[model samples]
Target chain A: MKSRDLFKKEHSDEQSYVVIHPLDDQPEQKKDLSNFEPMKMTFTVRLSLIILRVYLISMILLLAYHFLNLTGIIKL
Target chain B: MEEKSNKIPDRVDQPSTVIRTRYRWMQKIMLFLVVFGPGLIVMEADNDAGAVSTYTQAGAQYGLHMLWVLLLLLPITYFSQEMVARLGIATGKGHATMIYRRFGKWWGRFSVFDLQLLNFLTLVTEFAGINLATSQMKLSPDITVPLVAVGTIIMVLTASYRRWESITVFLCLLDIAWIIYAIRLGFSFEKITPAAISFFPSGQGITSSYIFLVIAVVGTTIAPWQLFFQQSCVADKRLRFSDLGYARLDTMIGAIFTIIVAGCMMIVGYMAVHSAIGYVYKNPAQMATSLGAYFGTIVKSGLLLLICNASILGITAVSLSSAWAYAEVMNWPTGLELKPKQAIGFYLIYILGVLAAAGLVLIPKAPLQLIIMTVQVLAGIMLPSSMIFLQLLLNDRELLGNEFVNRPWNNWINWTIIIGLFALSIILAVQVVLPQLFSS
Candidate 1:
């Protein structure tokens, strides 16, 4: 009876170890990276982008005029 | 591609077995390859058309007097960029995001605004160089400008970040010809080598002109966009704290390459053939004209190719920096990993930048030389502001943890650089705007 109980206890410990680490010998698993980035653009973000675009276009035009003036195409 | 596996171990326990160790070795090699682009690309792109003109002019007009400046910049560049690499790995975020989160939205917005404006203006110079080179080759602006614009857009749009990196790296390698050109010129090292070692200043007039050139070299060598671009690139590559050593190695290699290219450029120009004009290095094309008179059309062809390559490299990196900063600030999906259709706002900003810059180059009879010179000078004026922010962020313990704060020695070097750059900028300003005070 003593020998049987010792064997049972060792087996139970092994089982618990396996439970804790299911793939201790496994080499690889494909990572699930989906849903890491949100799909929807928030309203505030959309608004900021629009404002940025307007500012960008205005600057481009202003830059063009400045270049032309420097080159003598337009005497600013 | 950025590694998805770096964040996870293959086996939870006993992951370091012989076979797994081999696998991990391969993984480390791949990670290094992915992290390699931004540093080298940013460094080489610094050797852009404006930079070419400035360095070549320095050599031809000033001789090896400025060679010491290039040599000194080697370490200065390395330490400044090293902090960027550390920041990115520690935070896994772009410079813009960190600045915004840590320094308040107002400061963040100011930095971004400054970056975009300077980037846009700088892009003008790159396209201007492209226009000049292609025009000299008998390729009209109408054909060359649009084609380059389309080609740049397509290159960035169709490929992943890895692919774009490969293409730019290949283009940057073409600069090796400058070294060969220097060798062929048979640089009189017996004459200039001593001066180069002695940190001689080449004694150009101590007027605004000389100070302006000094500032231009510093500005173009350590451009502001480089800081942002490298940080974003580090985050995009998914670097972790463990990769800091390799990242610093990558940056060191870049700094070495940057100085070598600049050195070769100066050598090629120092020996350029010129008359009573006294080694005139007014512009890259003008320098080419003088060199061609002595060395034949081959000099022109070589100069044009180098300039064009630098311009294309600049356009891609600068526009990407803009797109990255804008997207990060607005909380949009970012990364070349995403499909264009998915990252519409991000990609749109990039395309807009390229097209707008190219379009400005199409302006009738633009003052190309004036524009390039002005842009580089303006860049020098604006660089100290960016460095201040970088210095602040790198020293922030809350952000980087205790292991990575600037050591006392590092702080000393940094403060010396900051003080030196600020002092020069101030002196240049006073000389330019209030010359009478200096004259007195």
Candidate 2:
């Protein structure tokens, strides 16, 4: 039987099936889920730090640039 | 092929007698109502505080020279957004989620970095907008800022998709204020010449300052955060192929509204400020005040109140979008559907973002002007890269399948925007750097 037909029959039988072309008949590999882990770090603290740092740097650079421009230290 | 006669009389042949339809009329009705969330909300969010401010600035500075850009962006915006809609529908995934899954951790982390940074900066701008708006009303920021923040939290958290979308659409309609304001400008209808036609640099002659502002207008319009937010909204709303028509319609309406508002703002600036006087104010409030003084009190009050309303509405929408993008990237429960407990991290992060922004405003020594300008520059720098990534992702056949993919014409326009933005950015940089070098 053709692999496509065989796979269809297996699917109808409530079984997982993998089809490989005759030219490249490698066996299908399944991913192992046992070692999977959730992300570490408290979401609140990390997110807060990220937001704080972004705001601070942006504000500093912006003000410095503006001051320089306004004081005629920088043109345009 | 030979066994067709012995196939136990196929289901089609046996089903001719006594047909009974299993109807799902009510379910279909409910689904139709629910699909309204993403399209309307995303569109309204695009009109947020920064956009209003940018439009106002563009109008004030260039008069109507940049009006063409707005008209041009309409189709571009619709096409780009439609691609995102398709991505969401085909994959049942958010933009960030797809990037993580397909490209693995490196690209995913890079996207996260870009999103978080941009979201934070944009959030600060939103807060500043709210502050600017409220200050015009003579309302204290302490009360106005907190009241607006709390109100947004309550609205986004408490409302279901149907209720939330209806309210957002209602707020979206407030954008009509621009139309009303623009009508007041009274540009010549017969001749219909664009107000400011000169391509030469305004004020400091071909300087970086003018170039940066020009780039800022474009950058702020088609932002990176918008891509993540819109795609996630599309996926979360669970749009399907059948709904593509409605989705496209929604996007077209939004793009048109965005451009119109932009055009009006420029006209108002041209008529009220640029024509009457040559000086440019630091923000929208001053411009509105200038309008009131030159035109009348009615125009002033109308512009002021509209600015405030636009600011509050925009901040709320963009903040929620930022939160949604972050949550989707982290693979956490994200959306207005989730309760505080269900998405504590998501909600908390958003609240922290608001508070930090507010805190910046409260600081005695903070440079608000610089913060706003830098945000604009950063937004400009990030836009081209995001467009490139979006174009690549949309064209990937494995992701989009045969249903939808970029055509050559689409590629032409997308590349045009990319090249245009790059040239604008370079011009802005040179404009800024060259003047300083020569002057020194």
Candidate 3:
């Protein structure tokens, strides 16, 4: 038995929503990132995102510094 | 493969009709059972191979002194995961898709790439753990690693979502054996009470070694993959807004049980400390062997089997998260319900992840130490950032709406957790990069 047929037999129920993409030419629900609207960057949201960016950069820099320090590339 | 329903079941107004009856309590219980898997599996699977070693080492070195830390972490774990459950139930989308859709391609791509790299590295460590555990039983990695790898793939490929979840949940319950084993090792409530109450190890103060181990415990408990795994799992399970309370309860129960099992593992480690040959710090496999020398074969075999089980759980959950996130971002078909023929890209990602990790572990001169160190640093970096994304997503009023958007108090608590996790991640990074810094 082919897996496509098996899938058809198995999902021949009210519970076939599990197939986000179909084997047949049924309608595509577009369960990907297509349907949702992108987040509207309000003032507070932009500030929060900036803070997150700063935090990530600072942490990554600190890690790099430590790595270089451990490798004897930089002192102090 | 025709989909009768266009979306994963998002029926928010269910079970209300089912509960308008004399058997409301029974109906509620049944509803709870339906919403149970994502939370419990994520939590138990969080206690992966790395966690087992960390807890056991804490026990061996400090006895029950660290029980308070685990206790402190219970609420933190519950709140963090509860928000994830809500987002998953509300959005009906995976975390990666939400990030990509909302945060734009740059940040989205960054998250997806980091998650794939970190999850794959972590999976390798899990397979290494399996090899180490089986070595205790004189089982060769050549045979066991590939066998378990194939088993994990088949487990996912051959089952429906519900069946896969049921099997995983049953495997999660087997950790109860650790609790029983802890009891058999002679842990009494009276014996652990004082240690549980104490905040720090008696007579050792706050040494760098102790601090490092403490940070390690924290890092192990809450990981980035967990954020991805649970949100995707909740979506995969198709939980609805009506099931939010039950899902929260499920997450809470999972958090409590995972911590208890971790505490039991710590007890096992503490008992190993008193063995005929006193506890010398080493890997869990050695600890099991040493304990077996005194307690007999059951101690060794039970610990090894449990470690192997932990590895299997870790591999499944971690690999699935990677697959789901990657496929979601690529707009490929994704779900356990889909046959291999139906969702080739998704299954390929999952299978390749398992096989690659397992194969790496089998190679004689694999650079496992470097891989482990990189995993640590990447995980340390990834965990806090993932939480930040989750926090922002949970707050998106447009996405979750007023009904599901986070309350102000949730923001406060989650921000606090993110900060605390940031500090732990930094400490972990330092420990990895400058090991000498923690030697004193």
TM-score of chain B of 3: 0.94
- For residue B8, model 3's alpha carbon misses the true position, in angstroms, by 16
Tens digit of lDDT per residue, candidate 2, span A1-76?
2222332223343653332222121111212222433223345324533543464355446547756877899865
Question: lDDT per model, in order?
Answer: 0.70, 0.62, 0.82
True contacts kept of 3: 0.16
lDDT string for model 1 (B122-206, tens) is 8888888888888777788888888989999998887477678788888888888888888767765576566554444545336
The window of 10 residues in a row where model 3 chain B has the poorest summed lDDT is B12-21
- Return the clash pairs for model 1, or none: none
Which candidate wins on DockQ? Answer: 3
Segments in model 2 whose C-alpha atoms lie over 4 Å from true places: A1-76, B1-37, B194-210, B274-280, B294-298, B426-440
- Total backbone collisions for each predicted model: 0, 5, 0
- DockQ, each predicted model: 0.05, 0.03, 0.13
Identify the superior model by lDDT, candidate 2 or candidate 3: 3
Report the C-alpha lDDT of model 2 over B1-440, residue by residue, as the tens digit.
10112222123223331122223453333334445556555655766677777777777766666776677677767777777877766665677776666545765776777667767777667777777767776788778777777766676677354456667777777778878777776665442453345554245365545556566666666777777767777665545554566566767767777777777776777666654566575677777877777778887778877776676666666666667767877778876566788888778777777767767766666787766655665565555556656676666654455566678888888778766765665444334334454342
TM-score of each: 0.78, 0.74, 0.88
- Superposition-based RMSD of candidate 3 using all C-alpha atoms, in angstroms: 6.8
Indicate which candidate wins on TM-score: 3
